[model samples]
Target: MIEFKNLVKRFGTRTVLNGLNLEIREGEIIFVLGTSGTGKSVLLKNIVGLLKPDEGEIWIDGEEVSQFTEDQYFPIRKKCGMVFQHPALFDSLTIYENVAFGLRRHFQLSEDEIKARVGKALNLVHIQGVEEKRPAQISYGMQKRVSLARTIALQPKILLFDEPTTGLDPVTTTAVNQLIQDLSKKLRTTSIVVSHDMNCALSIADRIVVLDKGQIVALGTPDELKRSTHPLVKDFLEEVLHA
Candidate 1:
């Protein structure tokens, strides 16, 4: 489980997160939803030590992530995986090498082990037989799946997704959302996804957290979110419903 306690982040004069408190349970799919610039991505970064909060702590599986040094944070980071807003694959590397990159860099695994792991990860995401292709050679949706495959290659206990369905068409978006749900259930990984896509959120989230102006304005299941009386949440849902 991940816990955010009084977390705060600021950039000079601007405060991006304001004493945010959240608890993400183990083996659950959590969706952090909000309008643009509400610090959802920043919160995910803090959980994995990519960004240090200005105040308070981020606890992952009972360990305080904020206290870990760069070297110490490595092992902890290894236990966690991330899928960025953009498919941040190395364009120069082939799909197999890219997916196996983490295993090669971090583990002392043999060539056969790396090959097996990479192949299994790709197969998990239903993107087999693309190992020789470069990132630029695949479609955007395919690239996203490859990125997801790379993330799962680490066999992480926790998976952090930053806007997983951002730029895809509705059908492709649905495919990614279903993959997220399937992966979380199959692997029992604690999945925390930050997204503005309400459909994706409603589809995969066990719980939804709505952030507005650096604070959690609402937190509930999809049904609860739809039934919420809070004007901010209702307004957001109404807009999505109309759109």
Candidate 2:
């Protein structure tokens, strides 16, 4: 459902993504594994038009969107839901309002419809009984789930998660990874998760793409990656093995 061809992204003197090409199938869960400064997040932004590539094209559902104007990208962005490294929730809004915010702004829905979507989204993330609570009143992990609830409320076809497991304890991280797997199957949405956790990738990803500097150094399923002889892939596997 998504394809990048000869993609190149640069920031003044630095080229973060260089001649990268990747194709993601619909209903697939892809894990992007890379160290910092490897253009993992940049790749996600480019997909949703939050960032544009300097060279080559990005195709989604057979449409080339590299040169799409903001208005042209409106629907594309709407079809994509991104969960950032941090839960960028409004401190002032209750969890219910936060989840309902996108629905209110993007679609003309009745109060009853909005309420139902918010409830369902929360339930999909395994969250419950915190609708009236503000962000500050919830645990950090719960707050993250609320953020996810907000994204899924829009019923997006593509889910872009940048460091979804960051800042969580191991137990919470494992739970979140399993949730990603469950949601992908339940909603049949394409998921691209940018993370450094090879362990989680192995447990949940349909495939893993490892990036180095600006290129894909390795790409394979978890078992293939585990058997890979590439030095960087070996290093990542070692970390996972010893973790």
Candidate 3:
């Protein structure tokens, strides 16, 4: 489980997260929804230990992550995986090499083991035949799949997705959404997604947490969010519904 207790982060005069408190349980898919600049991405960065909180504690499975040193964070980071808004693949590398990048850099595995792991990761995302192909050769949807394959290759206990379906068409968006849900269930990994796309959120989120000005304004399942009486939520939902 991941818990953020009274977390606070500031950049000079700007406050990104203000006493942010949240709980993410194991094997659950949690979605953080908000308008742009509401600090949703910053919250994800804190959870992954990329940024430090100026105040309060972050606990991952009972360990005080806020107090962890760089060395301590290394092992913890391995247990977490992240998929950025962009596919973020290296254009020069083949799909096989891209997926194997982390394993080679972080682990002491042999060539045979690396190959096996890379192949398995690709197969998990239905991209087995694209191993030798460069990332630029594939469609945008396929690039996203390759990115997901790289993330799952780490076998993280928690997966953080930042707008996974942002640029895809409705069909591709639906496919990516289903893939997120399927991969979360199959791997039993805790999934946390940050998105403004209600379709993606409603499709895959087991629970939704809405933020306004860096504070949680509502938390509930998809149905509850859709039927919420809060004007702020209703307005946001309506905008997405129409878009």
lDDT order, best first, reads: 2, 1, 3
Worst 10 residues of 1 by lDDT: 195-204
Point to the candidate with the largest lDDT.
2
* Minimal lDDT window, size 10, model 3: 196-205
Model 2 scores a TM of: 0.99
Best by TM-score: 2
lDDT of 3 by residue, 1-243 (tens): 899999898999888788988989999999998989888999989877889999999999779998777898987899899999999999999989999999999889999999998988888888768889998899999999999999999899999999988889999988888989999999999999999987778877999999888789889999999988877789888887798
| Reference-based TM-score of each model | 0.97, 0.99, 0.96
Name the candidate, 2 or 3, with the larger lDDT value: 2
Q: Model 2 clash tally?
A: 0
Clash pairs detected, candidate 2 = none
Q: lDDT of each prediction vs. the true structure?
A: 0.90, 0.95, 0.90
The residue-by-residue lDDT of candidate 2 on 94-191, one tens digit each, is 99999999999999999999999999999999988999999999989988899999999999999999999899999999989998999999999999
Better of 1 and 2 by TM-score: 2
Model 1: runs farther than 4 Å from truth?
Answer: none
- Against the true structure, candidate 3 reaches a TM-score of 0.96
